[model samples]
Target: MSGMQDRSWWGREARATVALAYPLVLTNLAQALIPATDVVLLGWAGPKVLAAGSLGVNLYNACMIFGVGVMIAASPMMARALGQRAHNVRDVRRTVRQSLWAAVALVIPIWLLLWHSEGILLLFRQEPELAKQASHLIRPMMFGMLPLFVYQVLKSFVSALERPGWAFAAGAFAVFSNAILNYALIFGKFGLPALGLYGAGLGSTISNSVMAVGLAIVVTRHRHFRRYYLFGNFWRPDWARFAQVWRLGLPIAVTLGMEVTIFNAAVFLMGMIGEPELAAHAVAIQIASLCFMVPLGIGQATTVRVGLAYGRHDRVGVGRAGWAAFGVTMVFMVCSASLMLLAPRFLVGLFLDVHTPANAHVIDLAVAFLTVAALFQLVDGAQAVGAGMLRGIHDTAVPMLFAALGYWVIGFGTAILFAFHLGWGGIGVWVGLAAGLAAAAVLMMTRWMRREKLGLI
Candidate 1:
């Protein structure tokens, strides 16, 4: 292809990816707001409540991220099925059906484990009271798991269909509903009892159920989705597809879990260092996560776009989809990194009262963390989009190995060395994080570049 034609083709794919990604990005932001609200409400309840709530929320999210990974398998599968033929309704519906089945299968054992979350926390030497209080949040929060997973399956369905607007609509409503319900129940406002952390958990539970059901209604009634008969013979089983989901999903789950748990581990490490460090780590990581939702959303879109091309055996199209996402992700990461570098204090101010004298040290540490965080933003976005690119081609096991090696072996090991032995403290942990992300980015992107040689296409 000529230079002009190549530029034009890449530009079109980039535009197409952004068009597909923005709603999903908004949806991720909406979902993020629910927890941010909880944190705010828990802060108002008390320091102890906030501590317990954070612990509980972290535990809940670790499990939820894993299950969502499993549910996400349906996205690429459906995309590929549809790309192979525009109306592979049977395969699409079957994929969704078994994804729901997989959700159920995964959630049961998880629920049993979570029911004993207090015991688990206790085993880790957490304070007994904190563990007990966290359980109050965990038990109620666990009830939301299946519903949230259901919502995830539906979300993947819409994303595969490239009609993500309704899912975003439903997520926005859920965010609003969650805030109101948590406010009422937590403070005993509007005739609700002051149940504190439990109220927060219960509020989220109800909101998730509503979101799932609302999307289900859309799937059934909307002319665009109705032809699939997604719920017809809901009891029938498809073991083959069920197995396929697990085959693809277990690795995805482990990959995501490694990524999530590494951050979670950073918190524990921060705790041992000092309250100010822990507090600062929380602030910096939250900001990074919010920024991360952008590339993460773009990555999800890349999965669909590339999966579709792969399904059609359009190798050039697959390259286009993957490279387009990579280019867009790098551009966004550059912008976000610049923001983090330019206004660390300003960003920290959003999370804490920077003017307060007592918060000075914490704010200072947070600013420092954000500086290192700024450094990692590029690699973080690259690895995320790179993983999505590989997932599009239905290659996961090796990437899972890459994630474990990069995130844990290199990342966490470096964190331990830098934070403790070398005495770099919190900054060391951030360095370790950067190292991990950098390694993962290099490995995943290299794999993507060699897709043709590796037979991934």
Candidate 2:
């Protein structure tokens, strides 16, 4: 009877988690599509454009991840509040309001940094012409950063409510709109101006604005969410709550920033190698990132579930939620890794011409990178879900240290040794990637386990 009861309980949790995760997964993939479409469209402009755009995107994302992490503090805060048996709606509303301010405030510095893309690229010793072109691409998109943060905060808000489908729908709409805009502006379709790389940036800016404003309307006007009056006096600042967000969010931001910079560092290293290697690395990483969205969505969902459980002070529930997300992520990653291993050439061909002799070198490098990417899928998913589990309980500080150690000290250091000293080239870089993600996964999962045993949640 006990065994049967256990099985039944697992089944129920599985069903609930799947229901929450699938939409969030689709939302994340749709978000990725905005950039993937840019890559596909921009590839037509030639390798220089592709490489420049890749570098610009990586730099943009490195900054964006920190903002994302800070805004994400809202979801768990709101989720935990809701999970309590008797909680103040005013407290939840205050958190939501303060988070928006924090997000917008964070966006300013990122936008300023993007505006100086050329100087930053030169500081990294990137080629002048490529740096200038990437700078052009970043300028228009700088306008979009504020709206992007707004959209992210709203998405986090809806996800905490366990109503992630609305965010998915908004993102899907944005993807379609972005594709059309890219088509029109990139090649001057339908009497549009020929902007080339700038078109991609403009399209992103317009798409982000649409998504932010559209989601804002939906969030404020939705029947269920209307009760909270999320928009009521939203502009008013709540300093204490803002401080609380900063206290909890800064570490989270640094944690995510550390992880993103690790890959960005790999991009920079590839740049030093050559344009072909850089372009190929871009394609391989894009594919790997697209596959990663599924696990990332599951991880986000796990944060909500576990956060709710923690708010209720249900340690067993937190463990169950975390482990459930881990299991699903592992299974999905296995399937993804198998696909990459079996069809690497086919996948790489999506972004570059694999059969052309002129592109053979890039194709070959990308294939090797994808192979290493496949090898790391298990650990990548583990670290992603583990971080989410820790975030659920508001444990960001230690995980931030763990990420710094794993990604920078171990991951980047090994990449440097293997790429330059051992002469592994691009392949060695990815090998180091696998090692770093594995270390992070072990550390984070162990932290969660220790917390569980000690009833920390």
Candidate 3:
């Protein structure tokens, strides 16, 4: 009877996790499509446009990750509130209100950064013309940053309440809209201006605005959530609640910034090699990142699950939630890695014209990058989910230190040694990334397990 009960409980947990994660996975993929659309449309334009767009996106994301990471605090915070008492509407309302303040505060510096993208790229040693072109693309796209952050905050809000389907629907609609806009604007279709890369930027800006407004309307007007008083006070600031969010969220922002910048730094180093290398790196990284969205969604679901358990002080439930998420992510990533390893040619062909003589070199390098990417998928999935689990427990500060040490101190250092000293080119850089993710995974998982066993949460 005892064993049977344990089995039943595990099954229920797994089902609940899957229920939450499936829609979220699709939503994340849909979110990915915005950029994938840009890559695909811009790829058709030419390698120059593709490379310039990649540079712009890399620079943009390196900064954007911090803001998004900060807003992610809303998930666990709201989850805990609802989990502690399912009808704790005021707490949930407070968290949502405060998160918006943080979002607006975070975007100011990001806007300033985007305004000077040209100077930053030049300082990073990017080619002058490419830097200039990338700055042009990024400047217009900067308008979308606040909206995107707002959407993310709302995404965290709905997701924590276990209402992921609404977010998914909104994101899916945005994806479709973005694709159509990219097609129309990139090539002068549908009587729209052919602004090339700038068109792609404008498409993102418009789609982000749509998503933010759409999600906000859903949250504010939906019958189920209206009870939470989510939009009750339109003009009040709760500095205490805001500080609580920032205290937990700032470390998360720094941790994520460190991780993203590692890759951004890789892009910078690859740029030094040549334009073809940089373009191939961009395509390969984007493809790998798309695959990453699966585990990322699962990780997000785990954050909610673990957070709920933490709020209720259910230690066993917390362990089960984290490990269950870890198991699913590992299985999925293994399959994804297999696809990368076995179908490198088919995968690389998606981003480049493999048949074209001009793209031959790019395709070959991308295949190599994909192979290295395959090796890192497991650790990457582990670390991503592990981080989510820790975040659920409101344990962000130490993990921030861990990520800094792992990604920059160990990961970037290794890349420098392998790529420059050993002369292994871009492949060396990817290998270093794999190493960094492995270290972070070990550290985070170990931390979670120890805390779980000790009943520290």
Best by lDDT: 3
Residue-wise lDDT of candidate 3 within 1-457, one digit each (tens)? 9999987888788889989998889988988888888888888988888889989988888888888899999999998887799878888888988998998888998898789999999999999999998887798888888998998988998898898999888899999999999899889999888988788889999998998899989988998777877778946888899999999899999999999999999999998888988999989999998999999899899999999999998988988898888988999999999999999989989888889999999999999999999999999999899999999999999999999988998899999899989999999999899889989989998898799465558
Off by over 4 Å in 2: 86-88, 453-455
User: In the order shown, what is each candidate's alpha-carbon RMSD?
Assistant: 1.6, 1.2, 1.1
TM-score of each: 0.96, 0.98, 0.98
Per-residue lDDT tens digits for candidate 1, residues 49-165, read 666676777778889899989998998899999999998999999999999999999999989999998997777666678778889888987889899899889988999999998
* Pairs in steric clash, model 3: none
Runs in model 1 lying further than 4 Å from the true structure: 46-48
Candidate 2: residue 202 lDDT (0-100): 94
Per-residue CA lDDT of candidate 2, range 1-457, in tens? Answer: 9999877877777777888999999999998888888887887677789999998888888888888889888878888888884344687789888988998788887888889999999999888988898887788877887888888888888888889999998889999999999878988999999898899999988988888888888888998677778879977888999998998889989998999899999998999988998999999999999999998899899999999999999887888898888988999999999999999999988988766787888889999999999999999999998999999999989999999999999999999999989999988888888889999999999999899575566
Model 2's lDDT to the true fold? 0.88
Q: Each model's C-alpha lDDT?
A: 0.89, 0.88, 0.90
Worst 10 residues of 1 by lDDT: 43-52
